[model samples]
Target: MLTAAIGTWKLVTGRADKLFAGASEERLYTELAPGKNRLIYLWGHLTAVHDRMLPLLGLGPRLHPELDAIFLTAPDKTVAELPSTADLTSAWAGVNAALLAGFDSLTPAQWLERHADVSPEDFAREPHRNRLAILLNRTNHTSFHLGQAVLAPK
Candidate 1:
């Protein structure tokens, strides 16, 4: 189970790394259309989601404030200033490293324990899912948005 969690995190982080690698500085902040979503906004939201969700899996908070700043915006807001590709890329690498470390430290019994903090009512129906499920959800969410960021217009 812990292996699965590590694999999922690696896969999602690799996708995010690829998305940022080919993008230019101009592309980082470019929106698909006027007042639409941009690469930075997508990356920022991913960071915010990670910040909020990863702690439930026993990972530490995000290390970068710029990434955390994305959480300040309401969910309805679309337009946002993007961090430079260099900065975004650096932060992503750091986050990936930290998450990998966390995953490495988890034991099989730890993975199976029901996280006390996550409410099933808050998410779907029940609150008894294991840590691995939460981690998988987060990985999927990050991958989904990373794909959107990659396809976003410059």
Candidate 2:
């Protein structure tokens, strides 16, 4: 199950890399629909969320905590001065690289251990709130954004 989950995550993120590579900088700014998030916003949002997974999984500190306010907490276009496409692209790569390394370091038993966010007591009762569960959730979240991002107007 761990192997399958990690493989699925890599497959989805690989598709995301291809999608982002194909999109032009200007096109990334265009919204998927009226009042919807832009492709660039989705990209940054994924990067930000994935960065948070580091600490949550006890992998390491967040590499881009600043992105939380811009991409995680705030709505799209609400915050001005978003990071440049080049910078965000770099961050996306960096975060994923770190996550890959961390994931590789963990044993299957470690993956089953409780993550950082859930309280020990709650986790004791709901043993499903583990690092692997968080990874699965984030993987699904990334896929959802990737689907939406693909619909962004030309």
Candidate 3:
């Protein structure tokens, strides 16, 4: 199950990375909708969310905690200053590379262990809140955003 989950995550994130890699910096500024998140925002948002998963999974500390305020906490276009697409692009690669390494190091038993945020008591009661669950949820999240992101280059 863990293998399958990680494979699916790799598939979706690879699609997202390819889309961003092929996109021109100017092209990423276009919004998915008239007032919805721009492709740039989605890139940073996904990077931020994945970076956080490092710590949540006890893989390691976040490579870019600062991204939370701009991409995670605040909505699109709300923050006056945002990182350059190039920077976020680099960060996206870095975070995912780190996560892949961490994921590779963990055993299937480790994946079934509780994530960092869940209390021992809670984890005992809610075994579903394991590390593998985070990967599944984030995989779906990335796939959802990737579906929207594909509209940008069109």
Candidate 4:
């Protein structure tokens, strides 16, 4: 589980770095495609989700709880405006750095432990829903959006 978690994080960061490269702070508000989310929104959403994981993994509180409203769910620019690109970028770096530190501190047994909201009974019933699994799922989620992020230049 530890190996899988580390490997998935590596994959996620690689895709994210490539996507963010050459990204323009000015062009972030532009839609990647015709009707999809703006490039900035995707970056903020991923940052918010990863920040929330801090609490879920018992690392610390979310660095930007304000982002949860617009980021936790699907993209909805009409509902709420996102923060500036610089702010989101800082939060993204801080959250990810903290996550890596926390993950490194966890023993293999802790990786198998249930995450924040899952009760013992529920965890026993659903062994696949452990903290390691959540990391893998979120990594895949980041990669999926990274695919959309690459469309910013088009």
lDDT (tens digit, per residue) of candidate 3 on 18-109:
99767887878888878888988899899999999999999988899999999989999999989977788789999999999999999999
Q: Write the per-residue lDDT of candidate 4 for residues 71-124, one digit (tens) a residue.
A: 766555765556766777788778888989998999898888889978889988
Instruction: Point out where model 1 deviates above 4 Å.
Output: 75-84, 119-127
lDDT of 2 by residue, 35-133 (tens): 888888889899999999999999999999999999989999999899998899899999999999999999999999999999999999999999999
Model 1 Cα lDDT, one tens digit per residue, 10-60: 877777767766677678668756776766667766766666555667676
Which residues of candidate 3, in runs, are more than 4 Å off? none
* lDDT minimum window of 10 residues, candidate 3: 20-29
TM-score of each: 0.74, 0.97, 0.96, 0.89
Q: Deviation in angstroms for 64 in model 2?
A: 0.3
Model 2: residue 109 alpha-carbon error in angstroms: 0.5
How well does candidate 4 score on lDDT at residue 36? 79
Cα lDDT over the full model 2: 0.92
lDDT of each: 0.67, 0.92, 0.91, 0.80
lDDT top scorer: 2
Quote model 2's TM-score.
0.97
Candidate 4 weakest lDDT stretch, 10 residues: 72-81
- Rank by lDDT (best first): 2, 3, 4, 1
What would the TM-score be for candidate 3 when compared with the true structure? 0.96
Query: Which regions of candidate 2 deviate over 4 angstroms?
Result: none
